[model samples]
Target: MPILEVTKITKQFGGLTANHNISMHVDEGSITAVIGPNGAGKTTFFNMITGVYQPTSGDIKLNGESLLKLKPDEVAKKGVSRTFQNIRLFGEMSVIENVLIGMHTHLKTNLFGIFLNLPATKKEEIEAEKEAYRLLKYFGLESLLNEKACNLSYGAQRKLEIARALATKPKLILLDEPAAGMNPKETKELTEIIKRMGEEFNVSILLIEHDMKLVMEISEHIIVLDHGEKIAEGNPKAIRTNPKVIEAYLGSAAIH
Candidate 1:
């Protein structure tokens, strides 16, 4: 079964309908991309999935359980985690600390146990640090584990955000515009990392990205959205030649 199933979901703000009867699914252990021009309600679609905005209509299910009425944290606990389009890292904290924070959702130590430094709590903390290190290493940020998040370069910071999200060990990870500001070299590196990410971490990936090269290279499946509606969905080969997708990005003039 697909890890995430969004069915006929719609979201509105007063008179504005940000998303209109959109439906899509992400299969387990696959890389999926959601692509569109700016203001295509891509972010709105993500918001609904992450519980930042409840849908006005329709249902969202993760592993067959409805996610309506759940908060973002609740959604995370349900095995869905995400990184933002804009980096939202704790600037002053060390890179490892930032990732450790993401593991908070599953960490079980209460304040009392932590304050006492009980054996079990200490063991859990050690395992968490090791796992965080493993994630940073995967992203090649392990050596800078003690560096402040704000001090990292833009590309590294993006990787850090993704590492943090993976710290949750979620079944699915949502990435919003992950390649937004990378140079060609950085984007290339990221493309390779993402291609291997699903299998490396044993998770499914659903991302929104404007970088067509990255999207086409890494996405096994692509969903194209235009004006908050799904216009086409297929593998890269089909989407690349899809006339409707062409019109959405270029114009009627280009298609002719």
Candidate 2:
């Protein structure tokens, strides 16, 4: 079975329908991209998948289990993690602390245990910190462990958000406009990191990106949306040449 299956899902806010019967599947250990112009409802789909919004119709299955009704935290527990389009880090917290927060679902300590300073709780805290440090090192941010999240460079901050998402140990991760504010160098690094996240960590990715270069370079499959509906779904070559996709968003000049 696919890692995630989105079947005819639709979302409406009263008269405004943001998504219209959208369907797609994310294969295990593969990278998928969703692309379109602004207001194409790419973020809306992410919101539904991550449980930020309840779909008006259809089903979402992760590993064959229904996720339509689950809450965001519940979705995370079910092996789905995501980063926002706009950076949403704990500005006042240390970089490591922000990552540790993502591992909350795996923590074994209870509040009661912590209040009394039990041995098991202490051990769990130590292990969590160790795991957090490992994740930071993996992302090459180990040296910034003591720095506040807001203090990191823009590129580093973007990577930090991804690192935090990975700390959840999710089977699938949804990234919304990850390269939005990045420079060419940062975008290049992000491309490599995204590839590694799938190949090295075995995590499936569903990305919403506007950068055609990044989208075509990294995604195994690309889905195009236009005005709240899917217009095309295919490999890079096919999507690049698709007449409908061209008319909808990617102009003829974008193919090069």
Candidate 3:
């Protein structure tokens, strides 16, 4: 069975339908790319899957269980985590601390226990720190662990955001525009990291990327969306040759 299944999912903002009866399956341990031009409802579809918005119709399932009715936190607890198109990090906090915050859902300490630094809380805190460092090291950010998040370069910041998402211990990760604002070198590095995340970490990935090079290089399967609907779904080679995809990129000089 597929790790995630989106069945006829639709979302409307007033009279504007952002997603229309979109259905797809994300396989286990694979990188699935959702590609499209701006305003193709890629982010909107991502929001629905991550529970930032509920679907107007249809169902989403993870391992055959419904996720349509779950709240965002509940969804995360069910082993789903996502990184935003825009980097969201605590700028003033140390990089390691920022990652540990992502572990809040798994932490057992309550307000009272945290205030007193109870032994149990201390132990959990230590464990969280260890896990955070491991993730940072995995992403080549171990050297920046003690530095403020804002002090890192743009590419490092992006890596930090991904590290935070991974800190949540998700089985499936949704990456929204992971290559946005990146230079060619950074984008290339990100492509490798994404592949490693699936292979080494054993997590499934669903990516929304505008960088066609990155998408084509990394994704095992590609799904193209245009104006709130799926226009193409296939392997990288097929998507590259798709006429609809060519049309979508026609006026977008940057895409070519």
For model 3 the local lDDT of residue 216 reads 81
lDDT of 1: 0.93
Ranked by lDDT, top first? 1, 2, 3
Please give, for residues 28-116, the per-residue lDDT of candidate 1 as tens digits: 99999999888999999999999999999999999999999999999999999999989999999999999999999999999999999
Give the clashing residue pairs of candidate 2, or none: none
Task: Kindly provide the TM-score of model 3 when superposed on the true structure, using C-alpha atoms.
Answer: 0.95
lDDT scores of the candidates, listed in order: 0.93, 0.92, 0.91
Deviating ranges (above 4 Å) for candidate 2: none
The TM-scores of all predictions, comma-separated, are 0.97, 0.96, 0.95
Where does candidate 3 clash, by residue pair? none
How well does candidate 3 score on lDDT at residue 178? 88
Summarize candidate 3's per-residue lDDT along 66-116 as a digit string, tens digits: 998789999999999999999999999999999998988777889999999
> Candidate 2, TM-score vs. the true structure?
0.96
Q: Regarding lDDT, does 1 or 2 come out ahead?
A: 1
